[model samples]
Target: MSQFALLGKRRFAPFFWTQALGAFNDNAFRNALVMLVAFQMGLDDHTVSLYTNLAPALFIIPFFLFSATAGQLAEKYEKSRIIRYVKLFEIGAMVLAAYGFYTHHTSLLLIVLFMMGMHSATFGPIKYAILPQALQQGELVGGNGLIETGTQLAMLIGMIVGSALMEIAGLGPLLAGAITIAVALVGYLSSRGIPEAPATAPDLKFNWNPISETARVLKLTGQDRPVFNAVLGISWFWFFGTVLIAQLPNYTRINLGGDGSVNILVLTLFSIGTGIGSLLCERMSGRRVEVGLVPLGAFGLTAFGVDLFFARPDAALIHGLNWLAFLHSAGGWRIVLDLTLIGVFAGFYVVPLFAFIQSRAPREQLSRVIAGNNILNALLICCAAGFGLGLGMLGLGVPEIFLATAVLNALVALYIFTLVPEFVMRFITWVLVNTLYRVRIEGTQHIPEDGPVLLVCNHVSFMDPLLLMANLRRPVRFVMYYKIFNTPLLSFVFRTAKAIPIAGHKEDPQVLHQAYDAIDAALAGGEAVCIFPEGGLTADGEIAPFRPGVEKILARRPVPVVPMALRGVWGSVWSRRDSGLGRARLPRRFRARVELVVDAAFGSEQVTAASLEARVRELRGDRA
Candidate 1:
């Protein structure tokens, strides 16, 4: 479906505009206030720095203080109603901002900034949690992509428009105030059109006390390890972004030797790149929540960050050279390209992660989880500011700080990837599947969204597990033959992924027991564990006789058994039935189109070897 279809759907369109307009107004007013206090007032450097630092603090502090309560409110009342009220609050806030600007009251201006932040804080949970309610499971990636792209673009335009308006001789404050109120009113109108979204947790208890509610929210989020970890990953991205973008103004002036034009150039390049990458999420993800892009993003962030540092011009800043002149200078274009690509990679990395969290989080508590995310984002942004200040204090120039941040990003990314090898592993699998074939996954809804799941698929090739892992949003532990599990090079990936290596009883009784124990433990912990029932690759390119190992595992765990089949793999180079004699030959580029078909789950009594084999054959259809 086209991306705009999401807007026409009663579920998504209203919320999208409401959120987009909110973002636009937030940046517009904030930047306008910053310009008034910093440049127009002709404040000293120390005072300007103080207001600059306090602006973000005032904005973010509300998230930490009120997100818990906001989350509860979202879960208790209908989202449309709450959004309308928030827009009203925005109108009042903008009126106060206009007053502050007219009277030249810095204190009132800062208060309005705080109120703007508070408005955003209240809207935070609603912004993210509303998507899952509005979008079908298949549309989450596309929906998230559109939102991300729109948001970044809004931020870019808002800053530019706000700054431009603030510079107008007599019309600056009046225009900004008028624009802010208009946007707020439009957001309200858009929100009124939103269909009623019933509360997910109607009976959720209200906690008025921020301290206790914040603690409770954090504890609730901790219940889902993957969800909690995903939140951290998102928070970390904000940290990285805050540090990089905050230094751009100085970097442009000192290194690029461009005046105000460089600031616009940097913002334009970064925002455009991010918008492009965000839009690509739907296509790259195959309409699913493909987090493989996270690792890909990390790689690009580090690569371009390093290249940007090295790409800096050696000469000092020139007084009169414009942005065009700077670009025409030696090595200028490379710096621009590097910064733009870095932003592109960042977009690729973030969109999928957001979709993953939204799709996988429990429906009832999605708002609270997003609230937790907001808290962490606030904390990380604060830390980024401190880190940047410390670096400057330590005599690190802006360019040097950029270099340090890039190196640190690499280290942090490595640590996160090591902790969750699934990120890297999935990237590899996604690349192979996407490059070698067009993977069309069907019946994915049959797989349980939560709880212990045992997937049984025909092992057609060595890459079967990777293919399945890439397609499934939930992580799974694979049980593999000991020999294949221990293969050189691949073993590292398997081991890092913590896959279970099993051996036949006749070959190694100890290894067999260990494998079963691991599988049982994983299932007990509510993880998906996949096994090849045949216990070996298909020998003749046809469905092999059913093996009893799957039955035995189900007998012990009694979890829901999901039967899946991979078609079109038999013709791939890794297939056991490859026509080429001893060694298999590679297939033509993009010649293979693979499909993973998931069938309904079966109970223990309903899933013997015979019954399960019939189910698999039916799913495989004539291809089997």
Candidate 2:
């Protein structure tokens, strides 16, 4: 089913609107307050500046201080109930905000701002942790895409509405206050439809001390090296976005020589591009959480950020113009495309990381880990402010900062990818499998979610293991022939995936023993292991004789044995189908339709060399 089909379901639609409405109200209030302070208030420049700058700090402060407490609450109680309470708090906060707006009381409005911030901080854990429980693994990526798209679109609307409302005569405060209160109340009503998401760690003790608990939660977030790096990648995204979005106004005036309308235009393109990119993630990922998109996103962020600098080189030549006028000017299309594509890539970069976190993080503790991510994101936003400031102090222009940020992004992405090679490895495998062949998988549900399982398949080409690794949700450790395991470029991927290399007994008895030990250890430790019972790729577009090694392994440690067959890869470029006098060559079939058919699992005792081969042959029929 298309992910959009989720919108028609009771389980998803209500919760989605509640979250989106909450985002709209938050942005509307902030933008209204900013507009009021900037134009309506009869204050001097210094006071206006003081209040405007302090607003962001007040809003974000709760994320740093209360996120740990919030994570604990979500874990200790029901998530749906927490969300309702959060919505109630929003309504109360908006009431206070309404009164402040009517009274023109700046201090009261700031307090309401802090209250809204606290509400968001308190619900941060529920926002992410509830996803895994609410949707299936296959739907997780699409669900996240919709959330991202909604949030960005809501932000755009709220900003525009909030700022526009402040300019109206006589009834501006009444209109703003009424809209916020109504939205909050509606959000609470919407929360009513969000079915209960039971607590993940109900018996977990609450840590009242925010400082210690915050540290502990963050430590847990880093427990898995890959998860930690993914978290870092996400935080870095917020940092990069903070810098780019925060500087857009300055960049417009100083570099693009554009006015307020042009500023809105740039922001619109970025947000729209981000939404477009986010929506495309599910499709690009083949309806799975494809981390390969992460590398692709990082690459685009750097490439376009650098290009944006050159897109507007001579800002002095232009003067203040409206968005339309700016577009009509020379080189405008390039600038707009740069902004839009940058946002698109940003979407590509961020969506998968969230999916990865939700999918890969320990389920019971997912909320706490997300809370830790929120806390880190808050910190990164602060650092980005400092980074932009440092650049300004050096007398560099905003465009120069853009250039510097792009350069820094490249370095950071390289460092992160190096620390976690699985991301890059997956990218390569996904590219090869997704682009070079249209792989169709059947009986994926038959693959066990946990515990040990032995997968036996007929190998058709050198790319067999990679194809399996790329398509299967669960990671597999392949038992590969020794020489193929050492194949030059492919070896890096095998090593990173921790593929076990086995040699023939006559060639190397010690290697064979070690390979057996490795297979035994992997299964005993409760991991999926795939082995080609044929012991090698087909030499003449046929299944080689099934070796008895699988029987030996099953005898050593019995597990559910799954049988799979590959069809149509036999004539592919990766297969050595034509060989004569020790010479071999590949067919020219690229992007072929290859079918991966998996039969129901057989008991280890039920599986034998000959019987499994017969079943696999039947599954493949004449295709192989």
lDDT by candidate, in order shown: 0.85, 0.90
Q: Give the distance in Å from residue 50's predicted Cα in candidate 1 to where it truly belongs.
A: 4.1
Which residue window of length 10 is worst by lDDT in model 1?
Answer: 582-591
What TM-score would every model get versus the actual structure? Answer: 0.91, 0.97
Model 1 agreement with the true structure over 37-128: per-residue lDDT tens digits: 88888789999989987888888889999999999999999988998999999989988888888777889989988898889999999988
TM-score of 2: 0.97
> Alpha-carbon error at 401 in model 1, in Å?
0.9
Q: After superposition, how far is residue 23 of candidate 1 from its true place, in Å?
A: 0.8
RMSD of each: 2.9, 1.5
Compared with the true structure, the alpha-carbon lDDT of candidate 2 equals 0.90
